[model samples]
Target: MKLHEKPLIRYATSKTPVDKEGHLYKKGERNTSYQKRWFILKGNLLFYYDKRSDREPLGVIVLEGCSVQLCESNENYAFDIRYEGPGIRTYKLAAEDQRTQEAWVKALLWANFSRLRMLVQDLERTYEQVRVDSGPRHRLTVLGIESEQVTTHLGRPVHGRAATHRPAPSTFTSEPLENFVELHERYRKEVDAVRQEWLSKRNQQHGDPPVADLVDLN
Candidate 1:
């Protein structure tokens, strides 16, 4: 949808801690550079402001259909949120550490998929009703358009029999939210397990001490 036509729903919000700085970088000559802005994830919307608890947001990135990538530490130790939405483009945000970057990624993904889960539930309910009311022999009226069959499988409509009594196959191992939580936990474990090696490789390539190099040790 168009930016102007987008809905404003605040599902969640978080920010960087004092010890761990966060930055919202806009694309410019210095794409790797960091900007001082408080990052907040509200549902699928990521907003930034000049300061904590700011009234107006500087910009927003709709995480729906967006892809995220963590830049190599040697470069900037920042992450990119690439979105194909409206006039806004990819956003490069810097976090204090790998953990922080992961946090942002996790939050953004949850927001995106959580919204999706809700949409899926709504669609499933509607599909179930249609399957029941329109039996295999009855034509279905949808959007004012009559159809020989709508769908029974949410994939195909059976022409001979209506399996309305059958409940939709349960795909989730548990509740959708619970499944997400489990996945998020798995992600954290995996990331933490590789914390040492990943940081070693990243820092080594990052020169280990880019800042200290600016000064002479002799």
Candidate 2:
């Protein structure tokens, strides 16, 4: 999906200690300290933003079968809500400072779309590996396509009813195997291209400097 077209959300947290330096007062003096913070997303997605004030957020981590949705109260008023999973309560955004809200929005967008795309690429790699390991004998028939009747390598019927009926071959022909390999390679390259493009766009948006080489201090 296009970046602008995708839904955006925000979540933030902040903390302030009552005292930064330890109290060096009378022995009977009482000192109490506490932290105040909260987090929310897309105007209604709320959660406890637990983190240190000096550190960037670890980010929103979605679990298995989790998904985000955009709901509208009116024709033009909409909010992005994230679901934990089926039949679970959703987290909503809460009140936050303007700067915190903006930062959260940026992080949310990156996590929702860019991170998700990376995960898709990983899954694609796993799928390609499984396909390769399973060999070429497996045929994927499209729905509504006619099923072909063929004989197995052992000279038994593949799909017809008979006393000696056996299953079809598990591997594909040399030509099909080569084609599959080529397609898998092309898909990997495409994924890499898209990832690089995304990284470039993110760097431009954030005004981040290009990666620097590591120095050997030793």
Candidate 3:
């Protein structure tokens, strides 16, 4: 079995109050209002939600949305779609926590990449089995032959039919190995690109000299 590339599928859904905020609501908090919504960002669809708490500085709500982008330069994008009762606000996560955002960004990228890898492996196995089953001569049939003066003959079974071959164990192993290798390579490249993007955005936010500037020649 050989692993081949396939398009990635994204699954997105939303629920009222969302997961995290819902937990908080269950904790006897009456002053907070929570709402959940779903929408597509770039190309990937995600669930976005937040809870409003009545406290000084107004407890901040973290709204999140994710999507996959095919553009070589941008493989995925995520943003916060913030809403405060009657008014709606949209903000890019990149704008906040410039120094430590890569951790979160990498996490999301890895999750999506992992799902794509699993799908590829499953597809490869199915295709390989199908090809093996379609081989020539599924079952042999006996034909009559002339005997004596009469053109009559009897037919009998010679060899028992072979059971569908259980695709060699090796075949199953090879496909996933190849898929993992390819997936790892692709994921590595994508991760690097995404990390670099984050770094660039972070640098832009601070408008400081590159990290190299902080190094002393002494």
Candidate 4:
């Protein structure tokens, strides 16, 4: 659907991340003629302008449930951005070359909010798992020999509770663990902040009310 919504335009600016921007020949629905327009893609919204200098966009396409694919056409590097909903027009576009066409298609496909959210969640899970795995207990558990036997530099076996208390391995230093924890905490804080910022920006773009409260990261 084509919309020149103010909220969308405002959201497009205001320090939003630009995923891609370029010139493309767009096939007009009524005229059936290709016109080159400047397009800027920010998150899921694709905004187009008659010229690159225009402050206001001609229209914006919300690519939430849209799909981009190559289309058979006389024009080289032609593709279509299609939405399944009623009243939504399929956008026909052509890039300069095959490489550019593929890049744009890839960017549009991954621009869907659902896909981006899933990617963010997956990264968070991976980071958390790494942090857990870096802990002393987990490292010891993985090194089964550490639990079964404790030995000295001289290769003598230890016995009882005293035997179990072997010095920490040189590989596992407190300094490195402390550094990892600090970096992990910083990364978590940054991710949480960016996630909240995205939520706010999304709400603004959709004209929805601001979220009542941020999710607890603890």
The candidate maximizing TM-score is: 4
Worst 10 contiguous positions by lDDT, candidate 1: 157-166
Residue 163 shift from truth in candidate 3, angstroms: 56
Candidate 4 on 69-165: residue-level lDDT in tens? 5667656777778866788788888888766776777667656633334443454564445444334332221112331231211122211111111
TM-score-better candidate, 1 vs 4: 4
Instruction: Quote the lDDT for 13 in model 1.
Output: 30
Instruction: Kindly provide the TM-score of model 4 when superposed on the true structure, using C-alpha atoms.
Output: 0.52
Q: List TM-score per model, in order.
A: 0.48, 0.27, 0.26, 0.52
lDDT of 2 at 84: 42
Worst lDDT 10-window in candidate 4:
157-166
| lDDT of candidate 4 at residue 48, scale 0 to 100 | 89
Best by lDDT: 4
Clashes of each: 0, 16, 2, 0
**Tens-digit lDDT track of model 1 for 38-71:** 7666557776667876655655667775555555
- Put down candidate 3 lDDT per residue, 33-133, tens digits, no spaces: 22222212222222232333311111232222222111111102222223335444333232123222233333333333344445544433433343344
Is candidate 3 or 4 superior in TM-score? 4
Please give, for residues 38-123, the per-residue lDDT of candidate 2 as tens digits.
33332222222334342333233342222333232221112233444466544333212334333443334333433333444453
lDDT of each: 0.46, 0.32, 0.28, 0.60
